[model samples]
Target: MSTTIVIFDPANASHAALLPSFADIHIACIGTDHTIATFTPPLNRDRIIQYWEAQAADAVPGRRIIFMALAGDSDGQQQLAGYVVLFRPLTETGPFRGSVEKLLVSPDFRRRGLARKLMDALESEAKARGQTLLTLDTETGSPAELVYPKLGYTQLGIIPNYGVSPVDKRLNPGTFFWKQL
Candidate 1:
């Protein structure tokens, strides 16, 4: 890979260029395939744009953390790869519960275990925040499907017709997975 994946808080001062990388990763993670199971809510770009702006400012309503994978080669001026965004409720009691909001690695940078590294960083963040349970969903055929299991995520259940298909315009079921940290 041409870029080094560095995990840092999005609240850092030098996050202007880094924001687009995070946005792109979020988009790539949710491909054009509507049938792919995802966590996207039904909203237009304006709303999402506003929401991300809030995220960039760490102004989201709940307990959330955003991480960016940047390039050590680009002098910290360019965004090289993907990012992971996770959320956990503060009202919950023992052991935190989390939703792996987003995880994506650039296509050119896949298969090098960056995703795992990002997840590791995210899990560490979650653990540090006192979260004990985390949940995320992925398409059955996507490369991500193999990742969580090896990382110790248990398959909780499958939700049929959970996503809309891009080709046929039909909904496809997605596999839900969770891990107890």
Candidate 2:
């Protein structure tokens, strides 16, 4: 199957259907007991859809929040394979920095390099916007912890008891990472 990575257009109603699957994927991978900064599953899909629409409408060029998705070709039936969000700070004066948020791939679509593809696209977009740095955080021992380092991100430090796991509701550590663009 061929897949294409593109910026999600919030105005497109077709993309809203993909949000539920994205929520399900995150819940399955991170467990129902944990919540990331960008998503807390058992998602309020309607509210999230509204939020994305608002963000997309209000987005400023080069300093906007974007949601990128990896989806099957539109030639036939289109399927949302994975997604990630890149948030560029809207500060008036400061070093340009972008943050990676909510990187997820469907369980049925794992092991196919979708996450890397999404991240690479995000990095390219950030650099093109003149961003000089990127930052992100992941569960300390999660798959993403390994993936980030492999993608050239430097570990900043681990935050103890940073968040509660969605599956078990137990506290979990989070590791922060940064990359110079």
Candidate 3:
């Protein structure tokens, strides 16, 4: 598999056009994969679009950074396999920390180390930008929660009822993790 990681540039119309594909990934994760996220089935597509569009509004260097994984399919067409986001303060001053968001790998692309690769790139990029620490949270016992410590992230703590599962609509505990760059 030929996989390439690209930093999203929403200022470019072509790049903005790809936002729908990104949303589709999230939708699949929730509806098909039954992953825990900010939403569940019977989702409002417009809400996802708006949320992603707002990211473009905050696309400044210090405000947000979105990285997307693209791979060539059997048909020789490139598709989004996964993506990750790193967000810092908008002022670009007095902050050496960033928050990790949306570390998503398409179900079809799972077990391929794509999430690891995306995280590796995110850490490298964050360090390059002078960030000293990164933080993220995921469903307490989810696969993602288990993967972080393997990526050098230290568990902070777990909060009960931090999120709702997409599949069962049950309140779930969430685990927080952090890594020093």
**For this target, which candidate reaches the highest TM-score against the unseen true structure?**
3
lDDT scores in order? 0.66, 0.72, 0.86
Model 2 stretches with alpha carbons more than 4 Å out:
31-64, 73-75
Return whichever of 1 and 3 wins on TM-score. Answer: 3
Model 1 TM-score is 0.77
lDDT of 2: 0.72
Top candidate, metric lDDT: 3
List, residue by residue over 95-150, the lDDT tens digit for candidate 1. Answer: 46888866777665667777787788889878887887899997666667778899
lDDT of 3 at 88: 78
Report the C-alpha lDDT of model 3 over 72-109, residue by residue, as the tens digit.
87888888889999897744574788999999888889
Worst 10 residues of 1 by lDDT: 32-41
Estimate the overall C-alpha local distance difference test score of candidate 1.
0.66
Off by over 4 Å in 1: 1-11, 29-51, 57-62, 74-78, 93-95
Tens-digit lDDT track of model 2 for 1-181 = 7778887665567765565565556555555325454445455666565655555554545345555555565576667777777777757684578788778777778888888898888888888877779899988888778999899999999999997666655778999999998
TM-score versus the correct structure, for each prediction? 0.77, 0.81, 0.91
